[model samples]
Target: MIQIKDLHKSYHMGANSLHVLKGINFDVKEGELVSIMGSSGSGKSTLLNILGMLDEADEGSYTLDNVPIKNLNEKIAANYRNKFLGFIFQSFNLINYKSALDNVALPLYYQGVNRKERVEKAMHYLDKVGLAPWSHHLPNELSGGQKQRVAIARALASDPKVLLADEPTGALDTKTSHEVMELIQGINDDGKTILIVTHEHDIAKMTKRIVNLKDGVIIDDNFVQQVRATQYV
Candidate 1:
């Protein structure tokens, strides 16, 4: 569902340029659950940003669901982002004052979904994430796990082609992390393509495939026997 070849990115400060991604290449297939692992300065975040279309690569090519992603104007880029990608972040990017239901409906609102259908779709996803009862609660009123679930529901409300999660469980406790991972695993089982950028080993194990990045390049890519997150939860 996603493809990249010879991808490269660099940030310039004054006269020096720090290359973040140097000749990266990988593909993520439909329904595949994959994790990108790396330490600080490993460029996993940069890679994810490029894939998320929040940033662009300085070199190489990216194709998402058969559409080339390069040099598009902001208008078209935003359109593709809405139509083809969903995002979950380390920080649950919810508007604090908005209730969970409203938060989930925000994406649909941007997509021009009418209020009635947005609420219905939002409720459906909130229920899917086990947050239907908490739909009226604000982000601060919910626990970290619940907030993340709300975030996940919001991401899914738009029904994008791919889900990109950046350190999704970073702020949660171990048990809560497992709970979230279990939910994510179930989503993958239902054939939603997911890419998680995580430094946690056990978290990466929960995925069907792992791609290790070091110094802006993929050092290892392999499928593994998936570790069910339920057992840990």
Candidate 2:
């Protein structure tokens, strides 16, 4: 359901042009769970940002389910992103002032969903993450795992098509990280296309296939054989 062709992106760090991604090409079909593994400065995050439409590539074409993303204007891009993509971060980007419920409802608000319906939908996702009781709790009051669950709830607020995760388990303890991975895997089971970028071997093993990136290019793309699953984060 996703395609990339001759993708190239670079950054200007003063005079030198630091190439991040060069002629990268890949495809992800519906219901496929893909993981990206790379060391630091490998451009996995940059690739994720471009895939999410939060960052523009200097050149190349990106198509998501038949829609060409590179040609869209900011407004159109934002709309498409809001409607189709969900993001999870290592930092658990939850608003401190807002309750878990309110934070999850924020995306729907931007989508012009009515407050009542959005709250209902938000709670539905929160419930899925086993955070229904913590809905009224603030971020500081929750544990790291709970906070991540809240963030995932917010990401699923609009039932997005692609879940783009950047080191999703980075901040949690072992037990908590595993819990979060279970939740993410469950979402993938429900038919959402998932693309995760992880530095951890355990996290990479959870996906059906892993794509290794180095020097902003795909070095190896294949399925791991029966990865030893670890319980907890």
lDDT, candidate 1, residue 139? 95
- Model 2 residue 191 distance off true place after TM-score fit, in angstroms: 0.8
Clashes of 2: 6
Model 2 segments beyond 4 Å from truth?
226-233
On residues 29-137, what C-alpha lDDT tens digit does candidate 2 reach at each position? 9988889999998889999989999888888899998988876789998999998999899999999999999999999999999999998999999999999999999
Among these predictions, the greatest TM-score belongs to 1
- Range of the 10 consecutive residues with the lowest summed lDDT in candidate 1: 224-233
TM-score of each: 0.99, 0.95
lDDT for each candidate structure? 0.96, 0.89
- For 40-98, candidate 1 gives per-residue lDDT tens digits of 99999999999999999999999999999999889999999999999998899999999
lDDT of 1 at 57: 93
Candidate 2 C-alpha RMSD relative to the actual structure: 1.5
